[model samples]
Target: MSINIDIRLKKACKIFREGENISGLILLQTNSDVKHDGIFLTMEGAVNLQLSSKTVGIFEAFYNSVKPIQLVQYTVEVVPAGKIPSGKTEIPFELPLKPRGNKSLYETYHGVFVNIQYMLRCDIKRSFLAKGVSKSLEFIVEDRRPVKKTDREQSKAVSFRIKPESLQNTRDKSNVPRFCISGKIDSLSCRLSDPLIGEVVIESCETVIKSVELQLVRVETCGCAEGYSRDATEIQNIQVGEGNVCTGLAIPIYMVFPRLFTCPTLSTSNFKVEFEVNLIVVFEDDYLVTENFPIILTRH
Candidate 1:
């Protein structure tokens, strides 16, 4: 009897944010004569963060800076060591990352997140042994939020990230999609005139007939949380804010992203990253929020 075993990742091409969950399916097809206990599937990772500073002032004072970020990875699996007839099967797994409190700054401890990788193999000496196929994924990340207000004036700011990533040797990219401001709202926080899950608006004054459109602002990229950790710098950040407004008012905004494409690279990764600190005013009504940051990328 003869049999064929092929595994393919079905949902691996979807977009993902850092703070959220990563779920996917693996399809297995077999037709000939084969017997294996249980099939196998796995998730692996390789992380890196790099930073550098360039100074330009009076003959080399302080001018500018640049940083680098990269990741290299692959996956494999194995099945039970037995043999039997042929059939089809599917497997699923979730890949999760810890919440990074800050970027790679201060010291080289927090900014750089490198984890051990795993390997999975499937073999049936009497059947088929597939252990030589692999794929590569490379992508960039960056986002932010800012707020400032006064008794008479209100200022608001917003920030996010975008750059096509190179994955599986295929360049699938997303554009500079605006963070439209989408989020959940508590029923108790709703007023008669306000709809739940509304747009982020600056409405403290009556003179302007309309509220201002807030764009993501660039704060301190590669900023250290101070004494907690140290880093070389590629960690990026962006922020958005509005001027002075009332002291006890609340504001909300939704996060929006561009449509998905054929490539595995995601355009806006809001849930998967860690962001900290802002000089702007943050409202009390914020049940949940997503931020974006910008970064410099070079294709090799």
Candidate 2:
């Protein structure tokens, strides 16, 4: 006989804010009647961290520092020791979404090296002779606090100009191509729900422009008093311009922050999550020039 288990959330989006209630149902189906023990449902949230190859050796000495951090954990018995009827049976459940004691709930984030996740699991126990069944469903958690007016008022727009003289870490200034790029970001503080807005103009260039692109980067740091490992990785790259054409035309910069892959900037004693944006200009010769802008992300 075959048994199947499915978990469905009342909210189709499967997204809940902090302090909210996670309401869902557990559906069990089996071809034939089966005797079992008890049915259990668990809700868990955690932050997992892993060091990159280069940083692994440094952290190997302090392995326990990188262990998964349990933010929340709760288990409840959905059904007492009994037999699940054949055909189909539905069990409804409601779990309060809160952090354990002194711990806090962070937004759900899926990243390399560092990840924060929330999940719901259902387990069906059977007799010693029978096989057990279990299922897990992932959900997203968002911060519930509102953005303060002071923070919003502090947001400021940034204007920048990029030229060879402005470049950093340039080995030979003579070999560097001549180019003048100017742009303005609407604001350094960005709301998660809004798109990053900006515009760039290529005023003059000695070489043909091949492409202009935008790169979103995530900087994650994990460590302890012994040491710390910080890694920066690209989250997404978008092409805003292609081919050598008008020199003075303004190019618009627009990018919607990808969900799950990004969350509000976070910092704690154990770790931190930050974001940055890079404007890249590629020449016909494949030589590239890049300008970096650190940004603060928030959910207002």
> Model 1: how far is 293 from its true place, Å?
15
Model 2 agreement with the true structure over 237-286: per-residue lDDT tens digits: 99999998578898999999999999988888788899999999999999
Query: What TM value does model 2 have?
Result: 0.97
After best superposition, candidate 2 residue 191: deviation in angstroms? 1.1
Error of 1 at 155 (Å): 7.0
Name the best candidate (by TM-score). 2
Residue-by-residue lDDT tens digits, candidate 1, 9-28:
33344433344444454444
Q: Provide C-alpha RMSD values for all models, in order.
A: 16.8, 1.4
Q: Report residue 10 deviation for candidate 1 (angstroms).
A: 8.2
